[model samples]
Target: MTRTGPVEIDEQTQLAARLRLVVGRLHRRIRIDGRESVPPLQLSALVTVEQHGPMRLSELARREAVSAPTMSRVLSALDEQGLVIRTPDPNDARGVQIVLSDAGAAKLAEVRSHRTALVARRLGRLDDDERRRIADALPALEALLVDED
Candidate 1:
């Protein structure tokens, strides 16, 4: 049923849609510019482990919001690449804890440096006022990520 005269969208909804598109596109551009070696999911999982320190497979899976099987596959690939090390959880003999290897830390640093440089270069193209506008919006933008619960 297409009875389209003029579909009304509230201001907040319009802003939400635009924000989502812009953020997604910017993230893609940064990842592409970084020439990431690992796929995004694996990279994200690696970052999570690095940030949270060594954790059990279930914990990593939960933090990454991925199923255990999927996280296992990602970890297996990472282990093959020497980006992560999995060791038996001392408290739970049956479970393994994931640790980010030195190689993984180096990889994350390289990717972050490249992406930061790319964004800095792009920001340099903008005028002073334009840059200030972005800086001013940053706090509000960051607030959007705060978990309500």
Candidate 2:
């Protein structure tokens, strides 16, 4: 690639675009395999519960960047699928804390395993130096997504 502009787009920017394209293709392929996992936002909620332990519906909604009603609907669906359980919040009689059922945990584990295997296979094709670059960038990418507020 030739640097033709006053502001040169570095290798990092080009790699980011390539990574996005690869991710998009992988997501499409996964969907075609009848995986039918929850949407991105719902997956985030599942992860929040998994990482932070059970939380109230409103808290999950806030953390997931969705309206409370929308969270309610998502929880309802997950509940119907036996993926989540709602327990009365110990702190409040009227509130409920969403918790993952055993089934949900297993499902999440399976999905994560599948995704990891897919990425691992792709990375296996790359040279050691290329894989090392991605390994080095993981922390920076994670930091960029971290919430400081």
Query: Which candidate should be chosen as best, given lDDT against the real structure?
Result: 1
Q: In terms of TM-score, how similar is model 1 to the real structure?
A: 0.89
Overall lDDT per candidate, in order of appearance = 0.90, 0.83
Lowest lDDT 10-residue stretch of candidate 2: 1-10
Model 1 clash pairs? none
Give one digit per residue, the lDDT tens place, for model 1 in 61-128.
Answer: 89888999998899999999999999889998898889999999998898888889999998999999
Over all chains combined, what TM-score does candidate 2 have? 0.74
Q: Model 1 off-target regions past 4 Å?
A: 1-9
lDDT of 1: 0.90
lDDT for 49 in candidate 2 is: 89
